[model samples]
Target: MSNLKGLAHLRMSLDDIKSATNDFADNRILGRGGFGVVYAGQLPTTHRSACEPGTPVAVKRLNVNSHQGDKEFLKEILMLDSCKHKNLVYLIGFVSEDTERILVYKKEDNGSLDKHLGSTDLTWEQRLRICLGAARGLEYLHSSVGTEHRVLHCDLKSSNVLLDANFEAKISDFGLSKIGPKNMPHTFLATVPCGTLGYVDPEYAISGVLTKESDVYSFGVVLFEVLCGRLATVVKSKDEYEFLSRLVKKYYAEGKLDDIIFPGLVEQMKPGSRELFSNIAFRCLNQDRKLRPTMRTVVKELESALEHQLINLDDDEEIIGLSGSIGVYNGHELVTSLCFTTNKRKYGPFNPEADNRFSGSWDAGLFDGFYGRHGSYIDAVGCCLKAAARPKAQS
Candidate 1:
């Protein structure tokens, strides 16, 4: 524990930790896992620590009887203390006195990404941003964290990706992480493979040979989880579990990815953005480890995907009305023409037609956008409206 001694500034007494967590009250607990329970608390700033005084924090108290012992605890402390990035969880301090093993981290207001999966609240753009942030964090760990060695996050899952108030991702949990030689194309370590079931790399698990690509494989599962809006593993029955990685590969190969895409997300996703994002995600899951892209490439692709999504957001324009033509074609009613009316001028009458026309005009309220179904042609149409802004009183 000599290395721990050098982190004295980050060491908090057991008494302080207990005080912050109200003596491990049930209500203070934020979450629980194989390691232990995490508590929400506000530690006094009196101690010389990384966080502000009285800042809200999450204090993870390790289970004494759990598999994670002093060794794992020490590894977590050392890993977090050395690696610092905006997209990585910030370690505030720790308590390693007597039988207790606790680590404190800056609290993330939005919690883990897993909690929001399959929910409509998270927009397509927000999910892309979250993925990009996590990728950057992983890239930092894999490339630049250490002078002689790069870190490999053996466990990369949605639960480990925490989200701040702004929905920025912060990769957490480093007890199972390993370090490898820097600048090596593939540094192999013969060790027992360990990671979350579905997220674990099959090659490493079967051969007990670990490499940087193992982390990439796990990250690939995470990318698909975000895109599909589900966990990597799902309970199929009492004795069986389904892995999302396999399903994604099958779906991608068959070009049936639309069947598994999160319900509302497809509507928000641009075709090009979805294509780019899914292509990268599919490439990540390739069976050949050599084919998996480096974390740097993953970051660039995510950036491009985000840029593609942002191309026609029309953030500057305030839409006020919509006019379009609907006609019956081949026994199906379809929208044939559409135009957006903004504060400045009309945008378009795409696929214009004069017959079977419908128009909606609003002056005070804002036009959110149009929503409808589409096949070979637009099948139906509806618009989203927002209440007008309340006028301010004169001073």
Candidate 2:
């Protein structure tokens, strides 16, 4: 077994990694990028090195053109390695050789959100959940100044959101990500615009100035993608203003917002959904960053929307019992049937696996602000639980 070090304090021998990748065979390759290619490989676990357990991992091999980016890669790894949020991808280790740099990470099973959402395999509900999960991840990064490197996810889009077995979202690829202090305390200077074509912040695109607002704006484009089920950059027009945001805004202004929503959800969509969802989407898509709602707000609204979806609106006021099916948190974390959201203060974490087999670890309670609140929020959680209750339940 190779001697391993703490993340940031470690690097793997290139020969060992190369051997795992069979000297970099095409079949071993998992993905490619402007700066590198990721190969699927099995590396020696520091604890057990004999047979090479072949832990499923992605090995990011930096290309020759990334001479300067190599330094940036190291910096990115060191900075990101310390963050332990569930929403962010974890870096396993890395390898460096003469003009060669490779980063290793756990291989997410489902691949990019774009691969599933862009294809027909994903359902409308899944799309909504994944996007919501991703937004929270970004929100956490933006809100927690210490964890985030001041700047925002400069290149967020469907492609950058990787999904795991249960379809949870994990942000990946920090290549063009801007490093700044949070709350836009400083300006990020760049000579050229660096981001995916469809999701680039308009202001950043024209001025080469990076801000948290830039990331917010790009996230807006992603919101539109989630809603419209199409690429923002692909909205071609033979006339003036070929941008997807402009078109969406125009349609929204013309009261044709429904024309853009994904067809499958259109039929199942609930009342008052268009305005709320449209408003949320437009707020994210707002050209002026100041007008956009913070990621926390966006996440809450989406969660509320999902809650709205869980119960029967026609008879929602009455308390009801609940039952089984897949329940998701922020469209990413999937927990089994048992779930609860109470306004109970100081509620703690519940790990079902510790006792019962099903319902895994869940936060004791969410909605800290509404804790002990005597209103519809608490009532709703209770009422919904009653409506879907398994003849008995507790948080």
- Top candidate (TM-score): 1
lDDT of 1 by residue, 1-395 (tens): 56588988788988888888789899999999989999999977566665667888999999999888888898888899889898999998889888888999999999999998888899998999899889989999998898789998999999999999989999999989888888678877888889999999999999999988899899889988988999999999998999999999888889899999999899999887899899888888777889999998887788667756654435456677778788877998878777778776775554336588899975635455554433234545565544354345689
What's the CA RMSD of model 1 in angstroms?
14.5
Q: Give candidate 1 regions above 4 Å deviation.
A: 313-395
Q: Show model 2 residue runs off by greater than 4 Å.
A: 1-9, 45-52, 145-151, 183-192, 235-242, 272-275, 313-395
Tell me which residue pairs clash in candidate 1: 45-53
Q: How displaced is residue 71 in candidate 1, in Å? A: 1.5
